[model samples]
Target: MTVFAMLGSTQAMYEWAEKNQTVFYTQILSRLMPAPQRDDPDVQVNQVNISHLTNLEAATRIAFALRLGMQAKQELEERREDLL
Candidate 1:
């Protein structure tokens, strides 16, 4: 929902989602929802293979990855300023 809003239009949202739908579930799911522990059986349930993803889900994953990159960039800029 939030990512769709950032995309600026229904068409853009549709295009981005369509482009990303083929990505494997593990690519995003593991980052979004990690098991409580290593080797946990619940991880299997989260690992279900799927051919397509909901538009909202795909948007959310892209939004999350973008946010992470933005944060890293901001931190680097701040560190550089401190050294100046």
Candidate 2:
């Protein structure tokens, strides 16, 4: 996420995430791997805003973004009672 580096603190990070839900959603969309045989094999999805990172770094960035996204949702969702 472009917002990853922008996070100044734990509180600020979640606040920024809450404000920019669409940005994270867009990041998730962009990071989705294309068809295996897509013509543009070299097409980089998550590296546009984030530059000068190695391949491993780019992958790590994506992973962190995904983790934060899921964490945000898990924090917001209401728990349900068990049927059993």
Candidate 3:
């Protein structure tokens, strides 16, 4: 049987999607903005320009970047605690 046939109807697929959907909002994405200039010294400035990307693409990239940053921060903190 076809995938749709197994699922019974398109309505069922739609229902499943709606039920499992996790919406991403601009507000949430804004909170994950790139680091401010304060975090990096003027000598080695880096920048993130998301003006060309769509909302979803920008949000996904920010989320991944934040996750990596958080992981690295946690590891450093843990190592510092261990050394103390």
Per-prediction count of colliding residue pairs? 0, 0, 0
- Candidate 2 positional error at 71, Å: 0.2
Which should have the higher TM-score, number 2 or number 3?
3
Better of 1 and 2 by TM-score: 1
**Pick by lDDT: 1 or 2, better one:** 1
Model 3 earns a TM-score of 0.39
Candidate 1 residue-wise lDDT, 1-84, digit = tens: 887677777787556657786553446545668668557665645353334878888788779879999999999999999999
CA lDDT of 63 in candidate 2?
96
Of the pair 2 and 3, which is ahead by lDDT? 3
Q: Write one digit per residue (lDDT tens) for candidate 2, span 1-84.
A: 557556665677677668888985687445765746656778867536657888898899889999999988776663422322
lDDT of 1 at 82: 100
The worst-scoring run of ten residues by lDDT in candidate 2 lies at 75-84
| Native-to-model Cα distance after best TM-score fit, residue 61 in candidate 3, in Å | 1.4
Instruction: Summing lDDT over every window of 10 consecutive residues in candidate 1, give the lowest-scoring window.
Output: 42-51
State candidate 2's TM-score: 0.33
Every model's TM-score: 0.40, 0.33, 0.39
